[model samples]
Target: MRLFLVSQLLLVFISVLALTRAQTAPPTTTDTATTETSTAQPTPTDTATTTQAIAIATTTAWTAPPIFYPFGSAAGDTEQFENGGDTYRDVAFSTPFMFFGRMYNNTYVNNNGLLTFNQPLPEAHPYPFPTHGSEDFIAPLWTELDDIGIGRYSYQQYTNGSVLTRASQEINQYFPHKGFSASWVFVATWDYVQTSDVNVLNLHSAPAITFQVVLISGGGYSFILMNYGDCAATYYPVEAGYDTISSTDYHVIHYAFDGSYIPNLKNTSNVNVPGRWAFLVNNGTETENVIGVQLKLSSFLDLTLNENIEDVLQKIKQELVNRGASSFFEMKLRNVETDKEKNVAGRETFELITLT
Candidate 1:
């Protein structure tokens, strides 16, 4: 009886140890996989999210960078240079001063330095109208406005305003006093909402139709509407006397009409317009014919200063834009100004001095 009782206790101990091992030991691979498949399996939505993330990463990858456009000349000396990073070409110039720079206006930047186009290019920003090396360094942004004067210029902050209906705007655009403004009024067939500010060359459109407008701040400009679709807006002619100067406000209006009235109002079958104010008047409603307008500051300068850098180690970070080149570059340095006065230089000063 004693031996049987001892055997029974041993059997119970072995069974209890087996049960504890089974509960505490790691699960087999097949068992773990079965549990994960039901709870942690990747869904279709998760797979699609991963795929789109990779596509965005691939498309936005930066191009081979650190591009350099190096230029300079020491007053009447012939100078030649080459870009070590990019351009895949050499530049040579025999002139007094070579135009090169990115920013820091009025101060000479470098006699031997490079202008970097992509200082970490952003995904979106104001792009230059004419890219560099286009037209042999001739800035394309001023292609239409170049006939007025060749200069380094951009739209000023003081000149920011929307076109008010029936309200005449007299904008004193940039320094040296160039460009034109108008008091304009219009009636649209659809409910009109002039929400976007009419920047000089930015495209503005209505949701109803495919037509667009640009209020380029030049004396004479041509706007080509990238029109498409099943809908097109038709423009009418101005009244016989709408182009006359307003007697009360002394505001002048000019119209280039279809030749039932004015002998010169014939369409030349070309898209280019002469730098004069005109209206496409049809049947007499000003709004029906005035699809667009041209404000005029028609002057001409032959050349512009581009760079004013004085330090070799200093490089202003700027996005490479085809904003195009200007014949005259005007700059202002707030650092050179005092609270009471501005220590600006004259626009007519240039140099050809030898450092030796």
Candidate 2:
């Protein structure tokens, strides 16, 4: 009986030892698997972090906004010549009038009435006169035409109230060897009366005649003219008033003229007959004058004028200034015509405006 009891105890002790060994062996395998899993997870996480960092570093920077410079006025002071005054003329004669560094007069008029070839007006006879009627008629003068280096030449004549002929001349020799191209405005300030006779005659004319820049050659020549008449007869003759004209690309050349005549020509003699015109080389710049806001520049890209374009231009100008552009590169403003007629009962103002 004692031997049997001892055997049972020995068997129980062996079973306990086997159970302990089995439980401890599983723990060892589990620990190894946990370590492997942790290590594998970190590799993918690290790779993802590295990729995210690279993408952030490669992002592009933002572009700055554009800017705008004004060409006209915003407020009051009736007599002042500054932009905002009531009587202030929004006419721009020449702004930044530069071509290859030298400043050339952009306002030119080629009427045969005002100048005798090569002869600038005597200081006394500044105003233009008719070419034919008066024996005293002076040949029209041109300061720069003889010196123009390149371009074709042409001439037209008006006779008996009609266009008589057009002629072309190969006068390259007459032009200057090298000169910067420019634009100009032509103005005619006159008082016309409906004569009892069939033919129209000038009752009392204050004709301010000038010539324009006509391109004979090269890709960038444009001529423009604007005439603003003060009396009713003058305005009615041309059907001139508020009007807007456009061109293809801003760089494309275009020519236009505007004129207006006031009623009761005698009463408004003091009121000036103002004209506005411009010539742009290489690129055409657009300007707008609003009553309340600063002047705006239109985009040259599409050459389409829009209400908000001015705002965008202003932003662009600000950005360019921030980017270190000089004030000379900044846009300029000008008033071309300001002189008032002295002889007329009512003041008649005439100007040749240009905006560079």
Candidate 3:
């Protein structure tokens, strides 16, 4: 009887051990398939989906922002451009405006889109800067724009305390160097101006381009502000920017060479302000120093795009060190890095970047 009891107890213990082992065993294939189903149901492609969304946002069309001065007949102080093709009107500034180391008290506002100091550029066709031309002009949009009985173009100058304060604040914010105070402000606007190539009788039915070129001067410093509004597409050669006497100091706004991109100027900006671009037209002694250094460096670097990029960079770096202009080189490197992040390699204008 004792031996029987011992064997029975031992069998019960063995049974309990086997039951525990079964409970603790690995999962079955079905269990694994269920888990994988939850994880693999198109949920792993989130990163790619986000990347696609970002690309769409980046490629979206740009529009003009409201950063322009008030204009039109309602403004009451504006002088209107005549309703004729390729017409120009001479206007005298209340104060002498300094531009690129020169002073001017009078300029002609041409309907085709240019401000000339000496005479009117009656030609409707646009030309690239350094035209090696004798005329000094500021072209907001040098296109064949027909204002004949259609669009209205106008000009206004302000020397009021309120206007001066606003101009000072804007220039300081955009350029951000030494503080600037404006004593004189000249505003020329091309409002609802249609391309001459268009044959529409009703201006409302035709596409139009509206923009402004504001000249600000004070404390021996000068600035130019190009404010764009709704711009229509065009097929003609369009040039927008400025040139000094003999093209000694000149800059062509981006997309000025291509007609398709002319409308894009309404959205493009140099200071990251949409619809607006601000440029320091005169820097006094600083301009002289830069030109001198530029000439010295130009002798070493072939900016004609004939040399390899790496070779050009090496030459510039060595020349900067020899001339104690390494600070300028470093600043350019920082600018290049910043522009690279924006993916504007060919579109951006940096110091010594003109490939003329």
- CA RMSD, predictions in order: 25.1, 27.7, 19.9
The sequence of per-residue lDDT tens digits that candidate 3 reaches over residues 152-209 is: 6788899886767888999888767667888899888875545343234223445667
Q: What lDDT does each candidate get?
A: 0.22, 0.26, 0.67
Q: Between candidates 1 and 2, name the one with more favorable lDDT.
A: 2
TM-score of 3: 0.61
Q: What alpha-carbon RMSD in Å does predicted model 3 have with respect to the real structure?
A: 19.9
Best-first order by lDDT: 3, 2, 1
Clashing residue pair totals per candidate (backbone < 3 A): 38, 44, 0
Kindly report which residue stretches of model 2 are placed more than 4 angstroms away from their true locations once superposed. Answer: 26-31, 38-41, 44-356
Worst 10 residues of 2 by lDDT: 63-72
Model 3 ranges off by over 4 Å: 1-65, 81-83, 147-149, 193-205, 255-258, 284-356
Model 2 TM: 0.21
